[model samples]
Target: MTERTVGLMVVAIMCVLILSRGMALAAPPLPPVPADYADKHMPDGWWTDPKVLAEGEKVYMGQVHPKVNCSNCHGKDGQPKKKGARDLRDPSLVNRFSDSFWFWRVKEGVPKTKMPAWKQYLNDEQMWAAIAFEHSFSHKGQAADHAHDEIQK
Candidate 1:
């Protein structure tokens, strides 16, 4: 209505906008990911697969046949903070490699990591089956291969 009133209102709105923009820019987000990565891609029918995920649930709950329960350290919910435990919900690592890579990791084991070789405890079928279950926890596919070496290899 009045020039002074309009100017004051404009100034107040500008200040509010400036403060909000500053605060938004100042707040740091937790855990960063690469620009090319899709942080979360959990799919449906994850728990429906009796062969992999359902059996993986059994392994997570410690009722799996052939034993070697994963729950002892990784926790029943697939969430663990222990030294060797991995963030099963994170697709970046869970979906890092192909099914074969997962099989190799389970059988041959991850070097220097807490992951132990399961070749002694589980057979190939069981291992791949477990990986299939892991898919329930991981994204559909691997992240973009940013490096030429990775693409070549």
Candidate 2:
């Protein structure tokens, strides 16, 4: 109703925005895949398979297993819902990681973070499926080419 009040409200909103942006987590450094998981790869053509992506979506959405709900932290669309959760839609982050790296993260989980090891609940296929789904957010219809490049690296 008053200029002073409105100005103060705007300043408060700005401060909150700045603080939130500052609090958002930066992408963590890529950790090495352990010896056991180093050779692991997603099924050939899994990225382009409609069935695989669909299965992955289910796993990501927590439909396949209660304990395997990636969406709880990573969010259904890959925009993390919780603090410290990585933003899956970030292309820069996606491009930096290989499929095996993603798989290892899913299977083993990141240390000192909320991300838990899914190996106890998800089989290899299911974990790969979930990762494929997460990758879809960044790669979209181009996953085939992206997968090929990552595999070659």
Index of the highest-TM-score prediction: 2
TM-scores of the candidates are 0.52, 0.75
> lDDT value for candidate 2?
0.82
Each prediction's RMSD over C-alphas, in Å, is: 11.2, 7.9
Model 2 misplacement above 4 A: 1-29, 140-145, 148-153
Model 1 regions lying over 4 Å from their true place: 1-48, 65-67, 139-153
**lDDT, candidate 2, 25-121, per-residue tens:** 6544566778887888888889778899899989999999987788889887888999999998887777677777888889988899988999999
lDDT of 1 at 124: 58
Candidate 2 clash pair list: none
Q: How high is the lDDT of residue 6 in model 1?
A: 100
Q: lDDT at 138 for candidate 2? A: 81
Which one is best on lDDT? 2
